[model samples]
Target chain A: MTNISRRDLLKSSAVTAAGATAGLTGIASASNHGKHNHSKSKRVVIVGGGIGGATAAQYLKKMDSDIDVTLIEANKNYHTCFMSNEVIGGVRPMDSIEFNYDKLAEKGIKVVFGSVINIDPDKQRVITKDNKVFSYDRAIVSPGIDFKYDEIEGYSKEVSETSIPHAWKAGPQTAMLLKQLQEMKDGGTFVIVTPPNPFRCPPGPYERASLVAAYFKKHKPNSKVVILDPKEKFSKFGLFMDGWKRHYGYGTDKSIITWIGKEAGGTVSKVDVATKTVTAEAGEFKADVLNIIPPQKAGPIAFETDLVGDLDWCSVDHKTFESTIHKNIHVIGDASIASPMPKSGYSANSQAKVCAAAIASSLNGVPMPDPSWVNTCYSIIAPKDGVSVAMVYAYKDGKIIKVKGSGGLTGPYNAEDRKREELYAHSWFNNITADIFG
Target chain B: MKQTKLILIGSALLASSTFINLAHATVIDRATILANTCAGCHGPNGISNGPLTPSIAGLPKNYISESMYDFATGKRPSTVMQRIAKGYTDADIKALSDYFSKLPKKATEPKKTNNHHGHNH
Candidate 1:
């Protein structure tokens, strides 16, 4: 094929040269984005459609043209693992947090709607629950996390399935929990039990309590919210306490929500799903509705693939995201053990981009680019008011560590600045959601 | 499995590159393993004297390497560090830490402020 398209290519290359003059960057040329020509293209199979998997699909498509990506998700629609707490409080419509795979499909990501029953790393093939098999050159698993039902006594998956609901993954159960909260009468007690450390979203349960109380303060007025925890403090304890006080009469007899750290006799020992009661070291409290977000581990695929060692999360080459157990397999998002990186949507999205670049470079003959990343996690406290922690990182000394003079928490203040931060946080969330899914 | 990867990566590094890092690397010829992008904020010599920055020079090589290893492995979580260290190796970390640790601390006119905490040992 004596393609005179070279002339067109040369012209476009000149246009690209001109665009570069204006600081515009296009798809890395090594990637193949041609029509029905994926035969020679490299394939990246991403498992799970949560923050990490979804963002990886989008960013991988964005960074290169030739990467044929197939995203495997059991659910056709994904209700965000983030922001489900707000749904419990009836702040935002559950529909607002729900997403379809259409966006990824539009971006050329092949959506395989089936549960990944097995990950054959050696074969570089994934078998789904539907008995379908798809092979790839590389596999990226970001299967978020699963709860450890056995960790807490009297509370297991079957128990939650029938009566008490974890509502952690935020689907029908999230709606069910919200419905239960809505039907509670005045002066009713809302009990939220939080799990011990090494869980997804450390500050999530507290935020749920705060947001639920935010709803109750306006609607029920006499309702009380109690938080029984396994930890002494949380991500933004001081800020949370201040915000609670300002909004929900916290620290007062009339406080809408009361948080009992472990020191305050809040460690939960057992739960009775039938009676809707939680027995903790502090006291045995019964609630009209119980929301328990449990401790987590890397999803079943991570364990089944033998990716995780002693830890419950996958071990990866922090720089490349390649799993320690398998050469061509990379694990990102909440599934992998990225210690210095939280399992938040934003962090997972950021990680996916870096991993995509590395994978692309490795696929081609070029050396990997010098990887740098930025992350900011935003939490909605009292509606538009939000807070965030932003940082920029560089790799050094063979490990990924923070560069000084870069990152800091939002603030320990309760002034106008914090409110402004909330607005910024909301904007950041909108931007990030767009950056990840849109 | 981690041990295997570390060993495999170590042998790969040793087999691939002949040069090793010493005290300080000049801007132009920083080794591929050294990847002096760390110099952007930590200082060219690994010692940070800026008001808000921590000094990293003269720290034990493993200490420096361990910190990075934590970030890379997710024992620690920072927004940037996780992304930056997503794809590094044991040899790379060792080489980079030695390069920075041996370099003389960056020179600056010292100021008397709350440079109080020595290091979070």
Candidate 2:
């Protein structure tokens, strides 16, 4: 061998070291070294134990036994967003929607009872409000949705402290609304203002209205409910209308429910808090009780972590549910920008499974399997009368897209099918709660 | 003549898979086949060096299949065992399941090594 400079020797040694490292990966000898570069097992930390986060933890554990995973949430219990409407309508108690994380902890997962206040993607670290800093190889954020208080005038979180309540997040406020409605007189009007598009649970408000009407017919027959909505039509509206007609004498002078769409100026222009009257595009509507579902975005933790973009939703790689902004950090649920997939608990649960599978693959340095998701949203026009629309979704052309020919809407306002759907809805809730929590 | 040619192509393809199976990764389903390879690190009778490696004796056959299938399907990620299992056929997995199920649970002393990773159940 010819004599080489010391500096040259150092450079050659560095190259050799890198080559040796590459060879251990099992794909270093291939011509296209850049195509696939596998790494070692990674530690994945997921924030939020709601439907999405919990489901992801289960899936990831099922996928990989070696990956170290930790799930963090502010609350130990999660109230199901899908069924929370029934809680507010007094059909189901708040306990009906609540679920614990004990099942997840039993599955060899480390469940952290703390609020994630900050996420530094560059460092791959998550900082809790209590100052517990955790470094992770990958992280998933699914904090769910929050109401935009400013969009509705004089309707702030503080305002809801006493007089008016949004009850959008679906906890104490939900029970408060139901209690307020129960105290209203027989002939008094209960005004509900539906917010604009891009809100949680697209079918939520209608379900709330239907359940509340069911209660009114039983307790106070003369009480009337008016739904001022921004959208002209809604999911399962035809079914809801049919149920309303059958149960509450809708579409006549003796109707117990009145739903005015944007065309009829149903969308509220402003809320005058002192008078307890809402000024809509139609006119000022006075009420004994007001339930305003304001425009919503991702929850506060998601915004605090810088996971949201210009659209007030987290940007994610549709295929893996991994965040596009923060490397190795994934976002799912209502907070994630997954188009064609509505922000429903079922969608969140489904996305969680796909995310779990992907996380396992990335952590193990293996090939990620193709992912597909299923979502079914069930609503009750009455306790025993229900309707739902179910769909299967898949990623196509680099984004989450609905799988055509896989799902269809409920049939045109049928009574028998609606009744069957209600039974199925309750069963679906139990199965989903068990699937995510149990 | 074209039909004959197509038939020849299909027959060749079928014959090649048979040849590949025999040579590429021969599946060992018989007790004798697994007794030699797996028993070296694991126990001859399905016991292990300790809790460091899981005791596979008397495990459910379906659970064994699912565990092996998960390893094969990339659903359950592993490091060393993943590569070790890459060669196991479905039949071999079933056979291993049978062998492990028939064996009794026995324990042995843990081997001292450089890596100190261990979780006590």
TM-score of chain A for the candidates in order shown: 0.88, 0.89
The sequence of per-residue lDDT tens digits that candidate 2 reaches over residues A1-438 is 113432354345445544453322221111111233433324678888887888778666655544567899888777777777787677687897888989888888889999888898887788888888777778988888888888777788887867788777767777778788988888888888988878788888888888888888888888888999999998877778887888788999998899999999998868889878988889999988898888888988778878776668888998788888777889999999887888888788778767776665554444554456666777887866766766656567897766554454556655554555564466556656666777
Task: Give stretches of model 1 more than 4 Å off.
Answer: A1-41, A412-415, B1-121
Residues B14-104, model 1: lDDT tens digits: 2332221111101111222243334323433344434333456677778778878776666763333444454445665776677666756
For model 1, residues A1-438, the per-residue Cα lDDT tens digits are 122322355346545653453322332233222222222336788988887888778766654545678999988887876778778879778897877888889878998888988888877788888787777778899988889887677899887776788888878888888988999998899998898877777678878888889889889999999999989988767768887888888888989998888998998878887888988889898999887777789999888888897888898988889998898899998887776766776667767867876776665434565666555655666764566665666666656676565555665554554555554444344445555666
Q: Estimate every model's Cα lDDT from 0 to 1.
A: 0.68, 0.69
Fnat per predicted structure, each in turn: 0.00, 0.00
Write the residue-wise lDDT of candidate 2 on B1-121 in tens digits. Answer: 1000101123344333311111111111233223323432233344544323344667787876777767555566432233345445466678767767766554443343212332110
Residue B59 Cα positional deviation in candidate 1, in Å, after optimal superposition: 41
TM (B chain), model 1: 0.54
| lDDT minimum window of 10 residues, candidate 1 chain A | A31-40
Off by more than 4 A, model 2:
A1-38, A413-415, B1-121
